[model samples]
Target: GFQFQMGDGGAFEMMGGGPRRKKPKFPKGVPKDIAKSMNWLKGTEWNWNSWRNVKFDKDGTFDAPTHDCQGGFCRWSASPEGKVYILWGDAGLHELQVQGAMPKEQDQAKMQGLRMKGRRTSDGERCQATFQRVFDFEAAELERDLYGILGLPDDAEEADIKKVYRKLSIKYHPDKNP
Candidate 1:
């Protein structure tokens, strides 16, 4: 029998001991600058479209599905376009699905299920990649809060913001001001 040994900083070689716990995932496509600064894995880097989506709190931690806690084959978003990812089991992150040039209709047929479910890195961590879109919510800058998140120009009139906010709010908001 070959006994496993921990050699030289343990840089993630799969020759360990006892059943080989799957390795955690590293994010991809995130700019090195941003990654180094935030310490998060780019949500857009993984393929979670076919995999069920996962959600996270503003703090970058994984939340329960529909807020549920029983983790499984669930992922965060769809394709490379969406953000956030939570995979079930100890999958090699690289094995996870991705947005390739293949046609949408034929995707399921290509499933070998040989994938990696890279666990999500929190939204704010040093040497990590973050989804800027989510961070925008917590942003405090007036210009960013108003224009960047709200989708308005800084020069837009108050009336415009209110009107748009009111209309958009009705659909998503909890109030019945209408």
Candidate 2:
């Protein structure tokens, strides 16, 4: 049997005359820095023009809720050169070329303020998307009381929000509730 390993510890074993590759050990999900840079994409609701609202997890999973694809089964990965790839199961794969001024030594505050524009190519069709990091206080106020519903403080961290959401989801799931 022959075995091969990547620099990142991804291993391939020879089994039955074929190579069976093991999952990569590092960077299972989007890198923290990349996820943080894309946080502005949160809270966007689905529209006719877009497929769904994007949700990213630190564990490399994502959810874009829609009639077509639901739950956190989707996954995303990025390369060192700033290319983001999304494996949206059934919905198809999407490749995004993220363009922004991301400095290596900047603080989170500066990173949060970074706006980006990207060209997305999916299923042979191309489209352009722009991301703005600005917050609209008035619009947020007008939006439903998500914090209240989630039983979290307005200033809760993203991780806290996701934790609470998962807890509530399991608690109120139709199968469990019913």
Evaluated with lDDT, which candidate comes out highest?
2
Please write out the lDDT profile of model 1 over residues 1-178, one tens digit for every residue. 9989776665456545546333233357431122111222322122233434433332233333342234333233224332224432333221222222322221223423323333334432212221222222232122123464578887998998898888788878766653
Clash counts for the predictions, in order: 16, 1
TM-score of each: 0.22, 0.39
lDDT, candidate 2, 144-177, per-residue tens: 4579778999999999999998998899899998
Native-vs-model 1 lDDT?
0.35
**Evaluated with TM-score, which candidate comes out highest?**
2
- Alpha-carbon runs more than 4 Å astray in model 2: 1-52, 103-122, 128-178
Q: After superposition, how far is residue 86 of candidate 2 from its true place, in Å?
A: 0.4
lDDT of model 2 at position 10: 38
Please list the C-alpha lDDT of all candidates, in the order they appear: 0.35, 0.50
The TM-score obtained by model 2 is 0.39
